[model samples]
Target: MDTRRPTIADVAKRAGVSKGLVSFVFNDKPGVAAPTRVRILAAAEELGWQPDPVARSLSTQRAAALGLVVRRDPTVLAADPFFPAFMAGVETALTERRQVLVLSLVPDAAAETATYRSLAAHRRVDGVLLTDLRHDDDRFPLLAELGLPAVCVGRPDVAGAFPVVNLDDAAGLRSAVDHLVGLGHRRIAYVGGDVGMLHGRRRRKSFLEALARHGLDPVGVVDTDFSAAAGARAVVELLAGAVLPTALVFASDPMAVAGLAVLQRQGVQVPRDCSVTGFDGMDLGRHLHPALTTVEADPLAWGRAAATVLLRLLDDGRADDLELPSAALVLRSSTAPPPDPPG
Candidate 1:
């Protein structure tokens, strides 16, 4: 009645390899022949033997995890619809490789920087996924100094020091703006997130440029923190302003949803008085009456792509930048020509 757990020595014996060689295979150390490594792993699998996670990390100097440090207000992060699908996709990819995600929801820049340093210095993760790239990003050199591999989720202004998973943010905003212009909305307004972030800057620039192409200027531009309260506040000001816009283009679905409510509450007839459009194409948009018109860019796909790239980089020490699909406008009942075409 021997019911002992299988050991690495058993795996080595079954594969006709030395104990040290078996250790090398599990640690994913270099200098092991590819075919022999495969055979050793197969033997371990057959015996249902696996090295302890702590022991493996100590030996391999890898945590078998990836880091994602988000710097935002907790309340704002909780309401952001982009994460649900994006995180689902990231987890899907990491799970395949027996890896996990280490998310840090930090409140400020100092905490964000400290978190990255600690994660890198302690070897707590194989690498990190950089999001919310800022104007004149400081993370690039910091990551380089720490020798921590990273994948930027957006293109930074400067040359990338690591792989990039660039999204077509401009395309989405342009589509929203173009739709407004097509609908005879000369006085179109833009509601954007913080201009310091690349996505916010890109969308705002695109909105202005799109209108410039049509010989029109934005009736208004409100920069908020992509919060429901901020969105509601922006809408109130726009509605109360001296010159009301015929259409509103919100940079995020949450903001759009909030604005939609505000407009309806104030007795503003959507499409009859002022049409509305949003970005990110979230489900909440569709649930609202006169479903929100938005740009169809898949955040889930973006997350999946980013995770795939980071995993590849961690494996081989290098990965190439990838450009995801461009966004297109999803027309809905929320958008239409102005009630009275401006002469």
Candidate 2:
């Protein structure tokens, strides 16, 4: 049996290119022609040659990893259904490139900034995936100062040079609102996440616009922390009001699910007393007693797209912004026509 590891020299010879050219292609450095790069890669693949991680890192001055820091309570992150699915999507792309994900959850902005600075200063990650963007996000400037590459999961109204992977939050809200309006719901309420968040503001703005288009006014609007517990609280506040709305639109499935439990406990029959709709069509929504009516925005796809963009930026020093699938309304048993008014 012949057993010998293939070397770069062997690959270069087979590809009819110099060893320097092979190295350039493997390192993903600029100045390599497209055809030559393809030939070099094919030759390396044909020889079953995989770059040694340690050697590659040393030569490339890269960490071969990415950073993701969530500015939320660890408990909140653990209970929130979206993070797990989204992280899985990110891992799918990272696995393909043999990259590592350094994930952390912190309590406040100071901690989040510190985490980013530490990662960049220590050369622990090649890039980062920024999530939960705020209206006046400071991370963009910080990242620029750190000279670390990044991709935002949400589009910021403020301009920045970094690529973004964003979904159509406005369109999704419009669809959700339209669905409720179509179901003979005249007085619709909106339960949204923190208004400080970029997407939260966007969703609320869209909701108001949607209501205007239908010549209706919002019965109520409540903002919460995007947690199940917070959702329950919001529902309680709405229920305690002078007049109850015919329908409620929640910003997240978690909140909607929690609100459902609240309604049931309060003896309010879903879709009879009031129709409920949620954003973020997580699998958990389907398993509910009455499947949730929701705006289906795939968090998994969002994560994958964000990771892909960051990876591209890391490799080539440039990447175009990506727009993932627009949000679609998923009709389920949670919503129905408003009950006939009592004469």
Candidate 3:
């Protein structure tokens, strides 16, 4: 009854091959014939043997890992479906290449910056994926100085050295506004997330511009931090106002969902008393009572594309910015004509 983790020597002994050959095969180095490579891999698999990350790093100066430093409260991150879907995509890409993802959740911008510095200083990761691109992002300069290759998830206010994999944030928001306008929602209100982030601002601007295109003025606009609590607070503020808008468009699904809950609590019937719309097209939105109408963008695709780009940058020392398809609005039961249209 021996209980011990198997080692490379065990794999080699099982396969009747030298440990050096096993190393060569595991590292994907050439010179090991195809049959021998397969046989060695089979032995390692049977023995449950894997390379030691520390030894691999020291030997090749490659951590074989990617970094993702998120600046968000722990609760906030868990509440947002976007991060999980996006990380799933990133991990999917990394798993194919036998790489690991090193995630760091920080409380604020300063802490995020320090985490990036620490990762780079220790060579903990080969590269990083930058999410939540902000206005006047200082991380670009720091990452460049640290020589840490990165891929930005969204468009930055100013372009920098790294590549970006961003969708057109304005297109989806504009489409949401247009749908509401077409539904005869003239006195529409908007609930947007942090305008400090570039994507947030882009969405807000798009909503305003779309309303202007229809020659309609927004009844009200509320800003939140894209968290459910912030979204709920914004809804309360909107409800407290003297008059209520016919339709409300939210920047994220969680916000729209929260707003819907608030509307329900206030005895406001959706699409009857007020129409509602959301962004992100989260899966949870689909299961709502009336189902949610939303603008659908592929955050999962963004993660995959970003990871691919970052890995390429690490390997080739350069990668090109990618532009995915603009998010499109999907109509559902959440939106309809205003209850009381002008005669």
Candidate 4:
């Protein structure tokens, strides 16, 4: 028998066992005795008969790869600071197990469905991690139909048996709005995110709920795509109104930064005249002229949790609906009570 590219027969011959016995030992079947299994393994090592992972998976009807599907432009995802941090956490968990992560970005629902179907049908990945969940997302039903093990990154409005991992957005937003109210802000406006997204909807709901709890009326709500330019234009619109809000709660740090610039251009002093608060407590927020008063959500931790959950689903077939860590309100220089009305 050739030393290189040795086959199972070579291992069996070297171990002084039958080929079937060698197969049983390598496959971890109980038919082979402990001593026989050890001998076969030793012989296989000597012959460098490393089993092909793909072939093994096919024989066992299992795949060791995990899939991650993001519903956004791939290039934009790379530029976003939060996603990179989150991905690092996911990689850490997968690295420990020596598993592969297959990531894909689908711009629309049709593309997402096609990609998912291909992965599931071919068993390319053992499970999937779905991000950017929208209200009544089309992916949810499709995942169920495919019987694919999957976990979502946000809470779905409709309850399903699939796994989910999400941040405590409601509590985080409540704390942020309450903090602003405590600062003596009377007229507060909300610069919302894409209302169709689950996280954005939750944040908006929390904002209104907190305002109601504080016995304050909602001043204005501007729904905009999550972009710095959109946030800047929304702020300008608010400023152009006859009655400008004294405080604003932005859905994201980038938006808050953009709003801050617009306010500065109008010669409005932060905290002294108009207060600002941001979510997603990104590092850039801390470096702002007035440090942003924001909620701190650990994206890395979120990623790690999502990866772990997906892996667990694959390994044990134990689907878990997990809630990841929530953000805490961080009081900074960017927020304060509204200035007294001119007499």
TM-scores of all models?
0.85, 0.86, 0.83, 0.85
In the predicted model 4, the residue pairs found to clash are: none
Q: Candidate 4 residues 1-343, lDDT tens each?
A: 5445788788889999998787667667676778878899999999888767666667656677888888776665654566777788789888998987888888987898999999999998888887777877788789889988888877778786678898887787888888888878878999988888888888898999999999997688899876787889999988887778999999888889999999998999997899998888788889998899988888888888898998888767786688776788888899988899989
lDDT of 3 at 137: 89
lDDT of 2 by residue, 1-343 (tens): 6598998889999999998888888877889989999999999999999788787776686888989999988888888777898899999999999998999898998998899999999889999998888977999999999998999898988989789898997898898888888889998898998888888888989999999999998989998988999999999999998878889999999999999999999998997888999989989898898899999989898888899999989887899999888989899899989989889
Q: Rank the candidate models, highest lDDT first.
A: 2, 3, 1, 4
Give model 1 RMSD, 1 decimal.
5.1
Arranged by TM-score, best first: 2, 1, 4, 3
Global lDDT of each model? 0.87, 0.90, 0.88, 0.84
* lDDT winner: 2
Off by over 4 Å in 2: 1-56
Please give the lDDT score for candidate 3.
0.88
Candidate 1 lands at a TM-score of 0.85
Query: Model 4 reaches what TM-score against the true structure?
Result: 0.85
Best by TM-score: 2
* TM-score: model 3 vs. ground truth: 0.83
